[model samples]
Target chain A: MVRVVLCNCPPEDANRLARQLVEERLAACVNVIPGVTSFYMWDDELCEDQEHTLLIKTTEERYPELSRRLAELHPYSVPEDIALDSARVAAAYHSWVHETLSDT
Target chain B: MVRVVLCNCPPEDANRLARQLVEERLAACVNVIPGVTSFYMWDDELCEDQEHTLLIKTTEERYPELSRRLAELHPYSVPEDIALDSARVAAAYHSWVHETLSDT
Candidate 1:
């Protein structure tokens, strides 16, 4: 099973985390997207921020450890870790992602 | 059944598409992320492009029509429409997405 863990963070933090995740093999790839204008509600008020989002690709088996490591490394007190199901990855691509994982 | 339809396009195209999707109720929300450097092989040659991605939030029921609309509006002959499952959406958020759709 494949999943893409999504999180929005400061651009500097996002870049650092993406590199670390890939280097550690917690993620096969981490696509860092900059210049995101997010408008969401926090504390009953509308808040807008400029944030970068990381789309980290990994297998289901590694998610727990990945999430743990991400929490520890994240700057925010409660960092977002939304795992969306990559329900239909191509066989070759799926195999490549698994093969890249150090723990696999 | 929440899904985030992912697609990459030119920054200007992405911005216009995001607004159109939301305004048309094909998507409850659309996040436009710019500054994406994508490297991929097409027709046996490696190609790289600076693109913007749209993360469009919608429900499963509307996906077929949304896809049809997307195909009609997208510039490319075959624009990518990767629908990743938002498997663990909050109750309020999920309901809101469904409720926002005009067809619902």
Candidate 2:
């Protein structure tokens, strides 16, 4: 089954990362979402501002490689990268993801 | 914990559903991503076209309610609503999710 990862990055850097992911074909599809307001405490100060979110589509076999690549490319000291198995998805869509990635 | 659902919808009706979800508080935050191209089979025929993706953020307590509401409001007979628990997240962010939603 294809594994899914949900990630959020600063708006300034999100686009570049998305480009890299696509250029590498680490994800069959990378959805870039702008204007996401994220609220969290950074350095003991509560902050809320616009950011970008990425929906990365890849297979479980490629997850470790993808995660490593993301970590190397990510700018944040601690980036948000959460991977979970997709329980319900169109069968056709799942097949597409598997077909899109290179053999791991 | 906040349950995450990754859903894709026909672009024409994505915004309306997003609005409904926000108004209903099914998701504390709903991101509407435009210009998504989806390829799949409908009625045994291959179809490929643009669509929109939604990143719904809500607590686990509301997953069932949100799924039910989405089904009712969704135009598609088989709407895509998949919930998965986040494996890695900032502690502060996790708390924010819990605080965002009302009890259950």
lDDT, residue B64, candidate 2: 86
Q: Which stretches of candidate 1 lie over 4 Å from their true place?
A: A1-33, A38-51, A54-82, A86-104, B102-104
Worst 10 residues of 1 chain A by lDDT: A38-47
Worst 10 residues of 2 chain B by lDDT: B87-96
CAPRI docking class of candidate 2: incorrect
TM-score of chain A of each: 0.92, 0.88
Candidate 1: Cα lDDT at A55: 85
Error of 1 at B14 (Å): 0.9
Runs in model 2 with CA error above 4 Å?
A: A1-5, A15-51, A55-104
lDDT of 2: 0.72
Q: List the global CA lDDT of all models.
A: 0.76, 0.72
lDDT of 1: 0.76
